[model samples]
Target: MDPFEDTLRRLREAFGVGRTRPAEFRAAQLQGLGRFLRDNRQRLQDALAEDLGKSAIESDVSEIIMCQNEVDLALKNLHTWIKDEPTATNLFTKLGSAFIRKEPFGLVLIIAPWNYPLNLTLVPLVGAIAAGNCVVLKPSEISKGTEKVLAELLPQYLDQSCFAVVLGGPQETGRLLEHKFDYILFTGSPRVGKIVMAAAAKHLTPVTLELGGKNPCYVDDNCDPQTVANRVAWYRYFNAGQTCVAPDYVLCSREMQERLLPALQSAITRFYGDDPQNSPSLGRIINQKHFKRLQGLLGCGRVAIGGQSDESARYIAPTVLVDVQETEPVMQEEIFGPILPLLTVSSLDEAIAFINRREKPLALYAFSNNNQVVNQLLDRTSSGSFGGNEGFIYLTLPTLPLGGVGNSGMGRYHGKFSFDTFSHHRACLLSPAGMERLNEIRYPPYSDWSQQLIRWAMSSQSCTLL
Candidate 1:
């Protein structure tokens, strides 16, 4: 007997009965989710801290607040989003009305990552529910604390008849993937993204993959070194640099690199203090495996600042590396740790060329006092998101979509896009059943004169009015 069969069947039945199609039901679920975030704010923060060594402020701002905004946005716009969108009718179809109905995709599966477990799990859930789809959320087991809370408390907030929280690592996920789902939204790495896509392909299931890439940050010679250092350091080190959109490496000139090193060193010290391992603001690695991987990376690039690591605590200081080779292990992979590597480029054109050579990044950052330099980078490259003089702060806005392209990943979601992602836009036409005269041209069989008259009426621009 399949363990998830009963749960999947129950949800599919609920969806079949049209229990989730109404705007009121969607808004209710959104409000329930909003209350869940607000009521359990502290608990969620503690769970995030326990699971990933995230600071309370970091958890609140990035995870809790972002999820809350998604909930709020969905609740506020559900009615507007659910309405049928009227479309222009062709002359032949002028007697009928054409419109698009945003309908649910039935049962949806959401596989969230461990880095920002709650936010990733619930944010997509908010969208799936708002689009009138029942969802099964599988929170990352690596984030045990947050996963526990979601498995237990989250079901109580949302309607259990339609929503479920499944738990497990790879084996269980594999088993779950065997079952057909109407849609799947997965937030993880590209390696696993292939697995999810392959699973979805068996049933021709639609999928949205939010995967990561080595996001590049191009620091130009024109900017204040300290400002660029601070912004880059904060986002890179935020959530211990596990963020998918974090700037993975710095591309700047040798002169700018020299200036950036000192500024970055000062900024790291100011933010995390002399002993970052003991600092409350700093975070630890999620597990020992990741800690060992990060430790191995420390040996590649020459350490420029704060290369310290403690295996027992799974802690790596806000570190920097210089003289990093393009082919070195540190330069080759997405460093999902607090270590920042600076590779010198000869000029702005050279930096752009280097970025163009690699796979299109998930996010790109260009920092400069000159707007043209930033614009040039923006125009020259393709990335999921481009940050000019900023970091991943764009996530705060529900209007903008977050996603990736090419090697990074595909599909986008956030606020309304999330709802639209989980929904199917169905084309609908309505007309009186007995409009025999109006539909005569659409029917077969006619004399030459009748056919000519009908064709003219159908093709004439003046025939727009019925």
Candidate 2:
């Protein structure tokens, strides 16, 4: 027996009755979402703190504010986003009105990951609502505190007939995927990404996967070491370095690595303090299983700085590894923790070649005092997002999108792009039904003159119907 069939059917029924299609309805849903964020700010922050040791400020900036912005943008532009767009006409259809209609895909399923649970779930929910589609949100079960709040509270704010929050782990998700959905958006690892894609393929469902990868940062010999160190350390260790877009590893020469070591040490101390485990800015691993996995990774290379681990607290200090081999475990996988490995490459060409050889990352960074070096790295490499002499600060811009290419992930969403992703642009034309004389001339009776006249009328810009 299918447990979700009834719920799915109800949402489908609501969508079929045009419950989500109106501009006012979409605006109201978005406004309600914004209010939810506004009214429950501290509760959300506390949930994040419980799950990942995330500070209230980090929770606000990275997750809460970003989601709120998407809601605001969608509500402000709902009517404009829903309007039919006019298209150029052919000569044969001079009197006809041709336009593209942006219509909803009925019901959509969004499966969010644990790293940024609230932001990932709500951002895509914002798009599905704005595009006039009923949504089924599956929050990560691993982030139990956040998941409980969303499952209980978010539904109260949203129209329950069109919105539902289902809770589950891998087993329940597998069952959920067995049902047919108009669209599916997943955020997680590539291994799970393949499973989601495979499941989506069975139903011929369209999916937007936001998966993780080993995001690379290339440091040039011409750059300032302390500047590079601070940027890399903060981004790498932010949210205990669980961010999908954070710089995962460093590629520089042995000389630059030497300069970066103490600079990184200085930065880590400045940000998290001498005892990083007690530092409120630092976060612990998500769970004991993940802590064990990260603990095993510490033996990969010579630990340059901060290699302390406390299994009881799930704490692994902000660490930097040096003289690391590409074939080591730390280098083999996307390190989703507060560990940054510095691997030495001979030159910029070598660094670029290194990045190209692997799967394209979700985000890539290159730090240099010279513009030519930055350009060369940018020109040679491909990633979902790029940062020059900075970190993932570009995520602040709603105009820019966030996604991955190749093995990293697929599809994009943020601001207007989110609205467009959930909508289907359908080509339509309205032509006259009463022009019998004009219609009859082009039908049945074929002659040399008729053929020439019809061809000219259809193809020529200078000619039209009588």
> Which is the leading candidate under lDDT?
2
Question: lDDT tens digits, residues 277-365, model 2?
Answer: 98999877999999999999999898989889999999999999987899999999989999999999999999999999999999999
Candidate 1 achieves a global lDDT of 0.91
**Runs off by more than 4 Å, candidate 2:** 439-466
What overall lDDT goes with each candidate model?
A: 0.91, 0.92
Shift of residue 419 alpha carbon in model 1, Å: 0.6
* lDDT of each residue in 108-180, candidate 1, tens digit only: 9999999889889989998899999999999999999999988988888888889999988999999999999
| Per-residue error (Å), model 1, residue 160 | 1.0
TM-scores, all candidates, are: 0.96, 0.96
Predicted structure 2, TM vs. truth: 0.96
In order, how many clashes per candidate?
Answer: 0, 0
